[model samples]
Target: MVSSVLQWSIFMSIFSSICCLRRDYFITAEEHWWDYAPSKQNLITNDRTISDRLIQTTEYRIGSVYKKVKLKQFTDGSFRREIKPAPWMGYVGPTIKGETGDVLYVHFRNLASRPYGLHPHGVQYFKDSEGSLYMDGTSGRDKLDDTVPPGYTYTYRWSMLNTFAPTKDDENCVPVGYHPHVRSTKDIDTGVVGILLICKPGTLNPDNSRKDVDREFVLYADTVNETNSWLIDQSLNLCLNPQRCRQLFNQKNEAFITDTLMYSINGYIYGNLPDFPVYEGEKVAFYAMGLNLGLHVFGVQGQSFTFKRKRTHAVVFGIAWFQGLYMTTRNPGRWMIFCKVNYHFNRELYYRLSGMNTHCYSYCYNN
Candidate 1:
């Protein structure tokens, strides 16, 4: 009996270990041309008349220019050569998914013209995987992973430690971000950022789809400085007028830069964002991350969501931060999800709501 029990115990231990095995993801940082605003007709309008006559147009010429930048992404493993859509529409990197107690093996390849590295937030890693160049106690190869030069590759192993798991009051899935740490500000501004989703055990399927929610949306709010467009060769050539690039850059035109600064959601400005689809009763999770400077307040008109049983209409003061919201698709209609800041609201930071039926079942308050 003792020998039989020992064999069973060992078998159970092996099965548990297999169940806790980590997952691997291969991501590459490649430069790609991205059209920041794809809409031919701008949705922004000014009611003021010019000399008592109406002067209306649908184009914000400078803000709608295209640019090339490095983005972190994964390929679909296709054998035939085909043009792939920018990963996550070129706004952010593909969502890296894992669960509590799982390990994430990210093999990063830098295919851009300059050096960049992947640094993750809210994960466990040794000095070699930290992805930032600095004088730490470590020496030798430990510093090599910090800055991945162009044409090089680095593998970073990060463990989703239990400490970052969801608490009792928190949602089943937690959100984290990964971005280039080499020349942090410049790299981030040049479009090297992505999302990481760490879920509770059993909350995510083996394919990384969330079992608890019917749909998920990741929204990144950022202010893109168009003045930096000249830094990339493709953007300079794609300028509305090639000579305009020289004029803007050589003259150090501040007014033109300020006017062209785009307040964008997911690399889309104005009403260029696609409509989010959802069923009437399904659960929806909205994950938001604010990038760069300035205070950003996100609000959804004609709808309200509950956080901790407190009704809130908007994500207030979500400046250079990350937050998530879970809401039932109760009140569905053509709602407006927009930034409430005066500058952003009046500019091009709004998206239309569609494919939702109106059904208000819970109490909600307005902002």
Candidate 2:
């Protein structure tokens, strides 16, 4: 009788462990209209004038203008379908969560017109679930899951093995990005990017929320080339009118394109970036990455951060990669976090504060 009871207990434990080892995510690829800048103002310099700024600086185009493009993004199965919605609501994809030793079963449905696939980084997938197409010398059934056509669905199985797990020094959450490989450049440039976050085992609560973190912010600093933007001509015509676009493109196409390059933080320019709210003394983590081109300098006025165990005022010379900072909100006040790069600063790659009461308005003018 004692031996039988022990065996039953062991079996129950094993079954519970197996149940915790699997995480399934339902993701859908759909087309939606994303507003790069919603606040119809110069977020960089707070300039209210529109005519002169719009003509000279491509960074100032505001309002319900700009042509609507079919940007491919990942949405949760229950996410509502909308045209131009906030970034958090399926514009930049859902924040994927998983744990070490867990298997991620992603049911991906492609609703876009083009063929696309979900290729993830820092994870393990078999050849049939690679979600990428290349000359990898594989044939027959091995490459069947490379790209999923429009109106088709494919299930990608990814394993977060211990080999690819986060290191001890890594924060509770780590970021992973996924995009389509069919037309890599155009797809990413036209906004096919989404974020995936993997957490350490037992770091997430029963409700799938991060533990011991009050607030988390992920910033993708990117320079979007207007010429390569999806529906560039249509966007220009809608924003600046047909005759004006013709004149501008004819005389100074290169300059116009250069000026139109959107230096944005999470697709928001000027001060259109949303405010980050947090209470005093809460733990905060900022995950930053630079996409596309140019150097990104992330700075938060009135606060010092700890990056890699060193104290720094800002993350200087942030390249096109991932960099993280963990800090405690000891100093209470509304602060400004902006990119220190000259062009990015001038283009309004920053976010304003609404809460807290730290008096350091000097940093705003220094930019």
lDDT of each: 0.67, 0.63
lDDT for each residue of candidate 1 in 1-367, tens digit (9 for 90 to 100): 3443465466446445644556766677666766555654455544222101111212222435555465544543321232343322346777788888777788787778888898898887767778986667666667778889887878887877677777877788878778877766667767788778878889987667899888788888888665554244455555457577557656777754565566777777666666666667777787777766567877777667765446788776454576677777666665678888886777667876553555332222110
Clashes within 3 Å, all models in order: 1, 5
Worst 10 residues of 1 by lDDT: 50-59
Candidate 2 residue-wise lDDT at 264:
69
In model 2, what is the error at residue 305, expressed in angstroms? 1.9
Local lDDT at 327 for model 1? 70
Task: List model 2 lDDT by residue over 267-326, tens digit each.
Answer: 666766666665667678766666567787787887778887688988864433766677
Clashes by residue pair, model 2: 43-270, 43-271, 333-356, 333-357, 333-358
Write down the worst ten-residue block by lDDT for model 2.
55-64
Off by over 4 Å in 2: 1-20, 47-90, 233-252, 317-320, 357-367
Give the poorly placed runs of model 1, Cα more than 4 Å off.
Answer: 1-19, 44-63, 70-72, 75-90, 240-244, 357-367
Count backbone clashes in candidate 1: 1
Q: Would you estimate the TM-scores of all the predictions?
A: 0.81, 0.78
